[model samples]
Target: MIPFPESTLLVPRTLFGRGKITALPALGREFGPRGLLVYGASFRRSVAYGRLHDAARGLVEWAEWEHPGGEPTLDQADALRAAAQTARAGWIAAIGGGSVLDLGKTAAGLFHETAPTAAFHAGQTPRHAGIPFLAAPTTAGTGAEATPNAVLTDSNTALKKSIRDDRFMARAVILDGGLLSGSPAHVIAHAGMDAFTQALEAFISVKSNATSDALALTALGLIAAALPPVFAHADAPEADALMAGSHLAGIALAQARLGVIHGLAHPLGAFYHLPHGLVCALCLPAAIALNRTAMGDKYMRLSETVGGDFATVTNTLLATLQIQNPFKGQPLLRKNEILDQTLSSGSTMANPKRITPADVEFLLSRLFV
Candidate 1:
């Protein structure tokens, strides 16, 4: 097996544990004294936010930008870029879910770019290096902290996609279970499923290498064991394991890429204004069935890792988390558009099974009914 990806990018430094967040200010100081802090509403109101600010007090100069709501958007990114510029920030640190991190990551990555955010989202290469980006994920999913890509939506076109540059990778990451304590049960459930899906997809990705496979399998095991308890109780003792699993899943996916579930999640979530993790949860079983044949022995390996047949484990978890099919009775919107995007996605192309139009149609059909 290939030892590693022909090319690999990873977060250069990571700090993990209960109060690791307090280190953010010190970490950002490595970049410069001035920085921008991006976060979501819930985080802004939480006590951890106060603790973060207390730590930042004399160590760094931080300008705050609250992610207003909804998915990360090109417009929002541009606004954040402007905010960082106005603050003369030397780095950007985001502490929240995937959307908040994506916004901050995009802003920092594009801080020196001359063109519109849309240009990069449309596939233009970044012409300049961005300020240092640091991440602390509040959710146990997305692993935005470990990736070199930021998924954003272009509201004008309703296209949700990633703007990736090797330089977009975080300079440092803080994985603290303290950040996960305040997330609602639904958020925990959805994010846990998303993390599991990411780990599984990375394990089965055609681009997966020996190193990525090992990391993905470890992540799968950790998430499978920790997710259910964490979903039932956000502050469960296993939350730390869940957070570690999510981070590992992010790293694995960054190296190995993902499958159609992620490929489809982007467009479907954007079009329907659904939560991204929810979309991944709803699409995963179908993807498993689609890729099972090609997965061969690895499929059984995954089953064993998760402590049951993969399909049965996933369905059981979904039910335990009270995840219902939201698309069951809804009309399929933008079918042609969704199909086109799914076929062309970087994630879809990495599927263990080569995905066809018929396969995408089949997956959609399963969801709608």
Candidate 2:
């Protein structure tokens, strides 16, 4: 495995706990005087919004984006930055799910961009210093707060891209479970699946090392136990269960990268505007199977983590995720067509196994049928 960078920074200063979200008022006070608030439509409705707004009152100038659908594409980033500049907001506080946080993160970076959010992803330099960012996570997935990377969409090119590096990492992160209260069952399932894949992929990726493995293992265990009840009760305070896991997974992937599941899922999300969790759910099983074929005993270790043999546990996971074959309802595709789409993810390269295009076809065929 590739060694984790010894000097890689983890979660910048953080306030992670059950109800500690109340500290948002205090955090807003410190970073305040004037600031930009970026959030998603769904999150804007969540009661936590009122609380955050209340806390930030008078201290910050809020710039609300009710529609932060998944990643913020280059266009979205420009609009956000232009708006922020117009507002003259000093700090940026992003409150919502992975998509919202990602959009805010990218916008904060692209606010000073010369090329585009896509160019930033493709190694562009910043002409202006970035604004300070703060992220408050609503779901227990994607650990975007801990990651320096911000995923964006380039709708023009039909691609989902990433804006990365140390600068984008939040100066402070608040993980309060209260924000998770109204998350729907499907979202719970999707976010949990994302967290699961994050930890698992980081553990098995070529970029993994001892630090990442320890963190991944710690995250995998919490995700196994904490996710189900949270799915059933989106508001349930599986506090200790989730905090450690999500952050651990976040930090793990911060150093190591995620595999094919994420790589493949991005295109589907960019192309179809699908919920990230749903696509991730569908891809997880296939990614795992291919990884198993390539890496060997790692599959056994994964099986043990989930509590069964590779095949049995794998099937159970897919069932739990309610994975839908892309071809299932499409009128244009035959069974082979569905398999072809699902099998074509770029993330396939990150699989532990040396999966070929043909191998993906075989694996996806079994999944759909």
Candidate 3:
């Protein structure tokens, strides 16, 4: 029998279901009356927002800030911090997609610190504990709510990085599957693919422990079974499975770390302005092929877990979702720059297999149409 590895697992107190959003007001009161609500711009018109607003009425004093689209950036995080400070928020409630959640996490984590968000990105430790944070994720992807890290991009360098701390973990998380009904088909497809990639990579990561492995396997199975149906028809019964799977994948990666797929996805998304999930979808095949030799046993187990050959299953799913490599035939603006950035990523360091420069070149070659 394999021995359990030493690990530190952190997760929020979670309430998951179709109507879990209603519990937010009571959860918010745990921290204090005043809080900041960070959400996606599109969510302003969503029914989910109406439900949340109703729940907050007379229960909590909150200020709303809509996240301008795209990935969270340092400037955006700083702006959010400023808003929370101005509101004298005792907690932060993030309600939307990954970007909105990440912004909320960052703002809350940095609430008491006067240093710029970039300082934390540069490895500066925060001196004060942040306000309580609550997350209600609309999208099943990124698992940002379950994670203790918030990804933010440095606009000047166009490099994506993370502000990670155990304190950044949400105090409470509400995963309401009903919110997913409004997501576009493409959003579901890409986000589901990202969730799958996270599970797969964590399962095969060198750092994976027994806890991570178990969660990754369960997440992979759910994602494999749920993604297609959910993508084909929104509001599928399997939507909850996808949400749970995505959250589990996030938890798995938070402990086990990720691999080459995420390492490459970050640089690609940062430089090309590609959707993160799409980047993962595009890179999955090459990453799997590259890591196959090192992770043969894990791959076989994964294949068994998902009920088919891993490569064939993933390729078919990508095809069914109409997810193609957009980078194909598009010359990388700065090939060497991307290479350096990818190699320097924490995910790359955690990859199960050692990746050399030549291997990176070969992988990039395969991505071309």
Candidate 4:
């Protein structure tokens, strides 16, 4: 459990608007004329790092993370920490998806510490602070760009964990929907669902308070409206809405925390090699049903958001989307299945209703054809 003191949260100042990333160079210059730029392989990404580099000129020093998958493990954090130490970066500019920005956050958190980022994960040591960072997200996925915590897997133990500290929130965040234009449709579909779930989960989370609820609802409304345009249109207003909604969702989850969707989603990424967002998507519908069962009227509000009948609206929305590799797309959502394994992971530990493993078993068993 996080020891969050009741205090006002300061969402990092965001640079949002049409063509606002152009201001990043000036911000980088203000932070430091010379800082480190941490990233994964930029060869296949939305944001053009070369252009950002050109725009920044001598103000940015570049550091690279070897892992490019959207996930970052503790081992990768160790590697990144080592590189950051050698580079002695004054400020970190994290550009890319969740993994990439997470690496940047971890690097800042682990700056003073050395080796085995797992030690920090194990609670043997905790990160007390972080160097400044600027998040430039290339995808409309994981709001790691705005959050204070970073999740990483321990390759040796196979346990995925996080480095949590509000001190890690970025100094600035840049969102440019144009960057997601060329992203693979499969990737976009999965990540977009992840964003949608974030808003929903946070809205219903027990940790939620007045501040988080407002953000969560606004995010939920935007994400629901944005997904169609973001995915269908790709390069236009829809994309912008998707990314913008994702940013809101990220901030909401940071404050309200996540429900079972994430708890169950982690295991799939660890064991099944399924995409994180795909796992989230599979787990979400059943979680909705289960939570509605537990919270009484909470799901009613969500139902109202989409339409009078939540189940019917949900079915209509899920049916309309087409994706590549239907087999792996919503893996647990096969026709024979009635629910997802994440039912165990979904509302099980949720504050209002702590679902048991037996409940998970029953719900998921119904999912099989």
TM-score of each: 0.98, 0.87, 0.97, 0.86
Per-model tally of clashing residue pairs: 0, 2, 0, 7
On lDDT, the stronger of 2 and 3 is 3
TM-score: which candidate is best? 1
Candidate 2's TM-score: 0.87
lDDT at residue 82 of model 2 (Cα atoms): 76
Q: What C-alpha root-mean-square deviation, in Å, does candidate 1 show against the real structure?
A: 1.0
Ranking by lDDT: 1, 3, 2, 4
Compute the lDDT of residue 238 as modeled in candidate 3: 91
lDDT by residue (88-190, candidate 2, tens digit) is 7767778777877887787776566557566676667667767788888877788888888887767776556666767777888987877778777777777
Q: What ranges in model 2 sit over 4 Å off?
A: 1-4, 57-61, 68-71, 321-326, 329-349, 366-369
Between candidates 2 and 3, name the one with more favorable TM-score: 3
* Candidate 1: 10-residue stretch with minimal lDDT: 1-10
- Candidate 2, position 110, lDDT: 59
How high is the lDDT of residue 152 in model 4? 79
Which residue pairs clash within candidate 1?
A: none
Clashing residue pairs in candidate 3 (N, C-alpha, C atoms within 3 angstroms): none
